[model samples]
Target chain A: MRPSDIAFRLYLVALFTFVFLPILTSMVFSLNSDRFPTVPLGEFTTHWYKTAFSRPEVWTAFGNSLIVAVCAAALSTALGFVTAYTDFRYGFRFKPAYLALALLPPTIPLVIMGLAMLAWLGRLGISGTLSGIVVAHTVMGAPFAMAICRLRLSQMDPALEAAAWNLGASQWRAMRAVVIPFCLPALISAYCLTAAVSFDEFIVAWFVSGLNKTVPVMILEILQGNVDPQINAIGTVVFLTSMALVIVAQLLILRKTNA
Target chain B: MTDTDPLVRFSGVRKTYGTFEAVKHLDLDIGRGEFVAIMGPSGCGKTTTLRMLAGLEEPTAGEITIDGKRMNEVSAHDRDTPLVWQSLALFPFLNVKENVEFGLKMRGVSKPDRHGRAMLWLERLGLKGFETRRIDQLSGGQRQRVALARSLVTEPRMLLLDEPLSALDAHLVIRMQGVLTRLQKELGITFVYVTHSQSEAFAMADRVVIMGHGEIAQIGKPQEIFRAPKNRFVAEFVGRNNILPGKTPGQEIVVAADRMQVSASDPGEGALPAEFLSEEFAGTGIICYFEGPEGVELKAQVTEDQLENLAPEPGQRFWLTWAPGAAHVMAGT
Candidate 1:
């Protein structure tokens, strides 16, 4: 191989190693029968996995995270699709402003967004509840869903929906028959992405999820209490879950539409 | 409605987007079972007129009636005017058969009935075996036929076609034109076709409507529009005609290109002097352009034998005279 090609391949290898090494280290530690993670070889065992899952609080946290992710993904995807359809189908005054406001939440710093949600949901009396965490995640995730859906909608022929209407489909029927079917891939991708986002989120859930701890929140709590091997086991599970969701989302969005 | 009652009519119809008028004072009557083509340049409001008739666009100030029923506020889906778009706009996600059955599905027709009708149209358009194929798998012409079948499956009383053949190859365009004309004749439905192509409009249309600046320049049989254009715009837009100014003020005359004779020598009385500029090869004749008096351009279509006899060169002086009784005086300035 040419020297430049070899160098580029090495760079890519280094980049992936840098990204995955920490997760790989945690996975290795999750199986090691040791109190602390170290370079010296330790006997591999499932002791930490058993220990972490045995706790009722840990199980509750995992359940809460799943619930938040599903609810947040559904709510955000609905919001995103409506926002995208509005942008696609209408040409009203201040359209740019409408889009900016719709997509503005993600541009804010996560800490600030967390703080704002804590305060807003507090006034609504839903803070510290699982519903509050779901709402906060939905706000953060809607913009992503909106971006994906908007990209798909932009690629559509502007006349497709109108053609449906011309062929005896009313406005709602046209949406069901044409626009929704065309955006289905984007919708599913957005759902997976928002679900991953909500599942992995820690800061906003920490702010608003008062009593019901999500997985990330529980992991932090466990870390604050002590640096234990069980944290490594939980961390590996969290990482795998997020990665699975993200990979599915990526494949859905990148696939060539045979339509 | 009776065949002579006119299938569609527009009276004092005007459509304006803010300060820009897309269609101004359109008064047209499309007869039943007629093939009418609206020809114009881009942004000449031909599309807007079709959209209005299809209930996609509301007229600013007038009445549009389909079969004597006022249809100003009828929504698009409620109207039976199915339109074939310029882009075809077939649903990419749906297979060929599903796309054709869309209108029937929307109308809540039974599944088997929709399938039978869709198949009938697909077969009629010569797309029988490819029913289950994805839209992307089909060729451009096949997709075009799919779009036609999709619109025609509804068996509406009228069809609105917006530049449907403009995307086809020249040879394919000729083939599709024959297909479209044959289908229109067999269906005996009113076909409102909008096109910017002079030949497409002239070749297939029983009546050609020339639109310019959102107004009807002239509406007549293609041959009549070719033989006698009503005004300067009509004459110029229709093309291949020499529009000349009469000696009297505010008078203009239109002479067909074939009727104009180009002679090397002065032909005595009523001979107009012209200088040959260039010639374009038209299959049957050579269309010669000349710089005439008052700086107006004149066109004359001459046969190969006539061209060889004169042996005309660019910038060669010639006398222009028309056949007796061929000059038509245009109405209005």
Candidate 2:
């Protein structure tokens, strides 16, 4: 190879090592025979993986994360689909403001929104519950869903729905028949993205989840106390699962955009 | 004028957007089964009139009646008139058969019957084997056929087309003209077509309504509108013409321009011609220009064969005459 090509390859290798070295280290340490995460290299073992799975607290946290993710994804995607459709079809005054509001959550600082949600939910007697966490995740996740759905809705053939209406389809029927089918891929991508965001979210979940511990919050708690290698084992699992979810979401979005 | 009862009437129909009147004080009567074409420049209310007739738009002041029944209050779905939009408006997701059967399904027809009718329409439109084909898989012409099948399957009382062939290529537009004219005659359904092309209107319509500046400029058969226009706008809009000013006597509109030719049979007592200035040979005919004493040029289309007999050259003197009744009077700014 040429000298430049060799340099470029070395640069790529350095980049990957910088990003993934800690993750690899964590995985290897999680399989250590010893209890301490970083004392010394020991014989390879799977005890931490087993210990992490046997813990009831871990399972409860995982269950709470799953519930919040599912509820947030469902609510955000549903509301996004409706809002995008309305924005596209019947434009009104302050449309720009509504669109800006929908996009604000993703750009703003998460801690501020999390604290605001906590205060608002406390006033409404809805804080310190699984429902509150779900609400917080949904609020944060909606901007992503709305933006994706709006992009898809704007690209759809407006004449198709008009054709349906002219052919005797009622307004709702036209939406169901023509608009929904065309927008299905966008809807799926938005759902996947919202689900991933809700599942992996930490800061907002920490504020809103109160007594209900999510997987991320539980992981943080474990990391603060001891150098248990089980944290590494569970972190590896989350890292892999999140990687898979993100890859799936990207594939869905790419397929939808190409289609 | 032939029938006393107007099959479809627009009684003082008008459409206004804020201060701009898209259509103004329009009154027209279309006979049953008559193919009428509305022609105008863009934004001239021809399309607006057709949309009003189809109930896609409501008039600002007047009422529209179809077959003697008031239609101003009816929704487009209940109006029994289908408008073929300028964009073909075929559902991209639905296959040919489903798109055709959409109207039937919405009207709650039985599955078997709706399929049967849809198939019949597809076959009639020469798309028999393409029932399962997606819209994107079809050619431009084929898509137009599918659009027509979908509209006709509803069995509308009158079909309204808004520049339906404007998107097609030149050859396809000509082909569609034949298809549309034949289909209209074969089905014997009333058709209200809107177009900006006078050639298409002349080729298909039994009567052509020419509009300008949101008002009816003239309404007549294509031949009448072509041979004798009601006003300058209609004359300029319908076909190629060379307009000349003339004074009307009791029985004659005297042409005193030098760019005209008159037969000896037109007596000098009623007709006058100044001098022929120039001549242009236009294949089958010649257009001769005349400059009058009033300093305005006049023109006449004379056959090349007729010119050979007269042996007329530039600056040839002749008289031009037309009977008083031949010219239709009109007013415009």
TM-scores for chain A over all candidates: 0.97, 0.90
Stretches of model 1 off by over 4 angstroms after superposition: A1-4
Model 2 vs truth, CA RMSD: 5.8
Model 2 agreement with the true structure over A87-179: per-residue lDDT tens digits: 988878899998888778877788898889889888878798998988888888888888888888887766667667677777788878788
Report every candidate's CA lDDT.
Answer: 0.94, 0.81
Scored by lDDT, the top model is 1
Worst 10 residues of 1 chain A by lDDT: A250-259
Predicted structure with the largest TM-score when compared to the true one: 1
Tens digit of per-residue lDDT, candidate 1, span A1-259: 9999999999999999999998999999999998888879589899999999999999999999999999999999999999999999899999999999999997898899889999999999999999999999999999999999999998899889999999999999999999999999999999999999999999888988999999999999999999999999999999999899999989989999754
Model 2 bad stretches (over 4 Å): A1-49, A236-253, A256-259, B1-7, B248-333
Model 2 chain A: ten consecutive residues of lowest lDDT? A250-259
Candidate 2 residue-wise lDDT, B1-333, digit = tens: 344577789999999988999998899998778899999999999988987886767899998988788999887666677778788877766799998998899888999999999999999999999999988889989989998999999888678898999989989999999999999999888899999998899999999999999999989999887766777788777644545554543322222122234562446674656467777875546776666557656666677766666566667666666555444444432
Candidate 2 B-chain TM-score: 0.79
